[model samples]
Target chain A: MHEGSITSQIVENVLREAEKRKAKRVLEVHLEIGKLMFLNPEQVHFWYQMLTKNTILEGSQLLIEEKPGTVKCPKCGYEGDFQYVDDPALHMPMPTLNCPKCDGTVKIVSGKDCFIKTVKMLI
Target chain B: MKINDVVKAEEGEIFDIELDENILKANAELAQQNRELLRKQGVKAIDVMGSIGAGKTSLIEKMVQKLKTHYRIAVFKGDLTTTIDAEIIGKHGVNVVAINTGKECHLDANLVQKALRRLDLEATDLLFIENVGNLICPAEFPLGSEKRIVVISVTEGPYMVVKHPFIFMDADVAVINKIDLAEAMGVDIAKLQNDVKKINPKTKTVTTNCRTGKGVDQVIAALNL
Candidate 1:
């Protein structure tokens, strides 16, 4: 799964930061995961624990903050949260890429980020 | 190693370091470099993504048949294991590089960077990267192409466009392949095309029956090749 790959990246980043500061232990990792991304937080947490085992990040807390998906429509000059189309066939609610006001092709302004905001460690 | 030290360590000297870094930045930077390299070499590249049995290989073969005499074509076939698709495309006497992802579901920018090193980009005019037959994972990883094409056949059912909106959102050209079976399968081609347009209006939609080379020229035109 892509979640496994991304979580490994998180673990790698945390380990690198820990070693750079010569930190004795890592306490927490703060992540800003966007809702637009296909990543599942539970899957990310599962992979994080598995990847961080026997490392300085073992037993650390992963604090995730999910950001909303937002878009900007160039045609209608509409900027706001994207709408979702719900169906029984969909695995989850699918966010529409069209502008809410004009149904124009909207450019993604936010909610695609998977960032490491801050690392809390014992130096 | 004691419980007391563990408890004390949790409460002592917790420093929050500010490093607001995107995890996907590395891949994005590599993709940019790839775009530059291809542009400098005068090579046009397309990243083709779709589900398994979406006629991706057949469409490439048809393209090679039509454009082989006009330009030098090279292909990078991404599959989890076998180089079967590469073998099929290689029969056309073009440069075919098979990139086996092994256990990976999709080819990342790093993998493409390595593949680029092995190819003679200067000698190539058109490069087609057939991504591992997957709709979801490949959307997240861009392989640095001039265009991103997502192929979906009518047999995949009506909800493919709605169920996987991100891929359609990211696609530059959306090809609805195997239109020959639309009547038998009871699928409405126009509705599928409309769905793609609703998701990303900028995306050019093309319908093709790659078996008999029907609508293949339209695909070539859509790619601007």
Candidate 2:
């Protein structure tokens, strides 16, 4: 529901970029949504269209590219996408999801972010 | 940035700052604004972070009661969904506000700035921010808090210190909750202490059983409140 909270911010930045470049007639707005941010691209799109009206980005297209949630495993020399599933080898009582290599806990390398990475417009 | 005796443990990898440059600037500006407001108001900020169900809320509740009588307190509690933490803590009557993070793993400075609009930092002597309950995300950002406190329970792992050293490294003090279960789970307190020292020798860590109000007094004393 705070989609507006973030969307409004994106629109402002999109306008700032367009203005900095001294461009007119905005075109496509580029966004990079990180997996760790827990934001849905579809929800962003839904709000983007609704929020951009009557502004510099009015009728401008919003293009979003998702960055995966990657983590580095301490035990295994593997760094890639993370999957959370319960597993047993991790510890005592219950099975908890862990690193695929050495059953170690992995830390997210990136992907939890919501930002207007790049914005394209006509001069 | 100056190096502080922390090891990378490996070579650097190529990644990128995926967020918008403008948004990053905006966020930085917001953090500065909150920093000014906090200073102007004399509000002391404490950030609470831990894994899901690690007892962050219980410790906060106890702290609110402990500090409220001597001074006015404001709380900013973060959760992915539902204001249940805020609602529960509100019953204690300490002017607690909830931040529903929607899907974000951590709370950045900009969000804290927005929340500050709703909070009167001047009327309050102390402020506590309960970060989202996951250990992985909250370590990424600082919410302009004067003190950052990381809450960990005994059930998580003895290796928790090694698992999330960043969270603890920034913490002024550490609160280890669920102490009553330490014995039942065969927890090694000494090992946990060693792991914590390895991560951060400066962090003052304390174990607490929030359900029974044990060790909370020590928590207050550590903060000098």
Candidate 3:
């Protein structure tokens, strides 16, 4: 899964920053994940714990902030929240690409980021 | 304090570092480097992605057979464990490299960078990178290809396009393969294409029965190959 790899990258970045600052230990990691990313926060936490074993980030609290999905329709000039396609077969509702107003193709505006916002550590 | 001591301090001078780093940026940078490298060598590379059994290899085979006479082509096929697809493409008298991703569900730019080292880029005019047969993970990773083609067959049912909209949104060309089985499978190609268009009108949709080489030329034309 891409989330596994991405979480590993987050660990690498956090550790790099920690090392640069000469921190004795990491206290917390703050991540702002967008809705469209479809990344499971639990899976990320699991991977983070697995990758940070015996490291400065060990036992650090991970604060995940989920952002909502948003889109901008080009045809009808509609901007804001979009709709999700509900299906009985799917375990979760999928975000629809069609504009909620005009049902035309919409461009993703926000809520696609999986970013590491801040890292709290002891200097 | 001991250097290796486990200090779970409830109160301390907590320093906050605002990194504001995107997790996918590293791979995106590497992909840009790959794009520059391919451009310098005058090579056209296309990344092929789709669900398993979407006939990615077959489409590549047909394209290779038709264009081999005019261009020096190469293929980099990504799979979890086997080189079966690589072997299939190698029989077409073109240089083919198989990339084993181990447990990865998609091919990232870093892996493609390693594969590029094994290929003779200067001698190659066209490169086709067959990503792991996956619809979801591959959409998040870019392998520095000039174009991305996502193939979906009629056998996957009519909802495959809308069910996974992100991949189609990112794709430059959408190949609705297995048209020969459309009638028998009771799948509507028109609706599938419409779904693709509604997601991203910029994406060019082509229907093909890659097994019989039907509509393969249109795919080539769509990619400007």
Best of the two (2, 3) by DockQ: 3
Off by over 4 Å in 1: A86-92, B1-12
DockQ of each: 0.72, 0.09, 0.56
Q: What docking grade applies to model 2? A: incorrect
* Model 3 lDDT, residue B210, Cα: 92
Candidate 3 TM-score, C-alpha based: 0.85
lDDT of each: 0.89, 0.73, 0.89
Residues B142-224 of candidate 3 have per-residue lDDT tens digits of 78999999999999998998788889877889999999999999998999998888667779999999989999999999999
Summarize candidate 2's per-residue lDDT along B72-129 as a digit string, tens digits: 8888888888988898899889897788888887788878888989987768878888
What candidate 2 gets wrong by more than 4 Å, as runs, is: A1-123, B1-25
Which candidate comes out best when scored by TM-score?
1
Which pairs clash in the backbone of model 3? none
Write the residue-wise lDDT of candidate 3 on A1-123 in tens digits.
Answer: 466778888999999998898888998999999887869998988998999999999999999999987888879888887676676675676666767787577888888778999999988
Superior candidate under TM-score, 1 versus 3? 1
Candidate 1 lDDT by residue in tens digits, B1-225 = 556543333545779999999988898899999999999999999999998999999999999999999999999999999988899999999999899999999898888989999999989999999999998988888788999989999999887888789999888899999999999999999999988887788899999999999989999998888
Provide TM-scores for the models.
Answer: 0.92, 0.61, 0.85
